[model samples]
Target: MGRLQRLSSNACQRLARRAAPQPIIRRRVTYQVAGRDFLVISGYEPDGQRIFYLKKLVRPSLQAGFEFVYPANRRERYDRDVEAISRSLSLVDP
Candidate 1:
């Protein structure tokens, strides 16, 4: 499968695993950053916490990403930092 397809499939698998414990409120979003497209899966818990799993295919053979877990009630405080970190993603030669 292609990168985007694979990423989506993996994200769905992850969501299933997470859902086994409790129903997780989540959204699958796409963002354009540093001239690349990123797939982000954000999951929210009933207890006022959240998790973000961001991933992008940096190259045909590589993937790049990051994750963040924070209190949903304090999202305003974490939004800027999350945006900064997401914007910092870059394609590097290996």
Candidate 2:
């Protein structure tokens, strides 16, 4: 049993070493919203999947976070739509 466990562990380690690591490319930008600044972080994975993260600079605790994942093949459309949404973002006072 001990020999079997050792062999299994070695096999798992070998497989992990053989797998290619995904690279993360990210960009940080600040946008003006309602006269306040907000931080936006956007990035892409090695598979071309896109991710977007936004947070309020002034009051991060009050910010609601969300995540949207897009298929790798739709990178172009995702980029276009994210750009449009960023340009149209605004904060309204209650």
Candidate 3:
């Protein structure tokens, strides 16, 4: 199995362990800093690929919001790159 397959397998095991209580659950954690929202989420694709993402949300409003997602197995590198990109972000009017 490839890395993605292995990750999905592990997630399935963890999900099964939690099935005794509810069977299915999805969880996401988010926070805001410097007017930017950050989130961590876990999920699986239709092909059974385990997907993990660190997202940065910008221009939050009642109308709409823009977001960027970074997915890398190395958590530290992902975090660092996202932070740097977030710091350099600037919005321009259409």
Candidate 4:
């Protein structure tokens, strides 16, 4: 399961300090292509409702986050598909 990324260095320290008792849930899968690492993560509620998807380049802080859901049983395949999609992405000019 994935854990929340620290929004900032101080947020990390505050999280480590344990202010909230609610259970946070997430799942993460990471893959590397070329020399960069990318993360695929899903956040959910305790009752199993999805909240968002996050894909980020681990080193450069490039990221995109949004709501998306897939059947729990098919996540592995979908992650691979996402990897393929991500791998093909490019910054384009109009």
State each model's CA lDDT, in order: 0.65, 0.53, 0.47, 0.53
lDDT of 3: 0.47
> Model 1, range 1-94, lDDT digits (tens) per residue?
6565445888899988987887655553433344354466555544545645454646677778888777777788887888798689876768
List residue ranges in candidate 1 displaced over 4 A: 1-37, 46-48, 51-53
> Which residue pairs does candidate 3 place in steric collision?
none
Candidate 2: tens digits of C-alpha lDDT, residues 4-66:
444588888888877968566544322223435566555554444444444333343454333
Sort the candidates on TM-score, descending order. 1, 2, 4, 3
Tens-place lDDT digits, model 3, residues 22-85: 6445433334333344433433333333334344444554122234444435556666655675
Cα TM-score of candidate 4 = 0.35
What is the number of residue pairs that collide in model 3? 0
Candidate 1 C-alpha error for residue 14, in Å: 28
Q: Taking the candidates one at a time, how many backbone clashes does each contain?
A: 0, 0, 0, 0
Best by TM-score: 1
Task: Give each model a TM-score.
Answer: 0.52, 0.42, 0.33, 0.35
- How far residue 58's Cα lies from its native spot in candidate 3, in Å, is 6.4
Deviation of model 1 at 47, angstroms: 4.3
